[model samples]
Target: MNKFGVLSILMVLISVLMFFILRGPNADLPLIIIILGSLSLLGIIFAVISKKWLSGVIGVLSNGAVLVCVFFILLAYGIAG
Candidate 1:
């Protein structure tokens, strides 16, 4: 696995863990979301630049996971309304 793939996996895991651990009006939630989103985006960019199928797939999955987590966070905070 390339550096992008490894970092992508780490960021995704950290984001998932933070999503579960941080709940109820935590100030860090938005920061975490931003970090996850940025890392995911970077992963996608790296995948594109690298032009590797595996990296691209991993990047897409990682980005999707970040989006899902963001959706849930917004829903939980009633921001979706």
Candidate 2:
């Protein structure tokens, strides 16, 4: 797997784990979401730079998933408004 793919997978795993671990009544939730979003954004950039079709696709999808998760997390936390 390429670096982008690895990063994407890692981001996905971290976001999923964090979502469960920090689900409710957490003080660090926003900070975690920001960090995860930043990582996901970086993964997307690296995927675009890699220029490998499969890796780029996988990275984009996985990182996008994390971003989506972040959004939902914000919603659940009532912090997005």
Candidate 3:
């Protein structure tokens, strides 16, 4: 596999880990978002540099999904507050 492929795999693994980590009541929203966002950005960058179009698309979709989840979490927190 190429560098982009490796990066894409790593990003997916990290995102999964973050998801599990963020499941607790004491989880930090901003921290989780930042970590996931960084991983997604790196994935996209690697995909672009390596000319891996499919990985690039997957990176975008995964990032968008994570962002959406974060958005809803924040929204719910705001409403509850």
lDDT value for model 1: 0.66
Ranking by TM-score: 2, 3, 1
**Rank list by lDDT:** 2, 3, 1
Task: Provide the TM-score for each candidate, comma-separated.
Answer: 0.60, 0.71, 0.69
TM-score of model number 2 = 0.71
In the predicted model 1, the residue pairs found to clash are: none
In model 3, pairs of residues that clash are: none
* Cα lDDT, model 1, residue 74: 61
lDDT of 3 by residue, 1-81 (tens): 477766865776787788787768887766776777677667656656656667667766665666576677677767865
lDDT of 1 by residue, 1-81 (tens): 677666656666776676667655545766656766676676556655555678668767776768776767666657733
lDDT of 2: 0.76
What is candidate 3's TM-score against the reference? Answer: 0.69
Q: Report, for every candidate in turn, its global Cα lDDT versus the true structure.
A: 0.66, 0.76, 0.69
Better of 1 and 2 by TM-score: 2
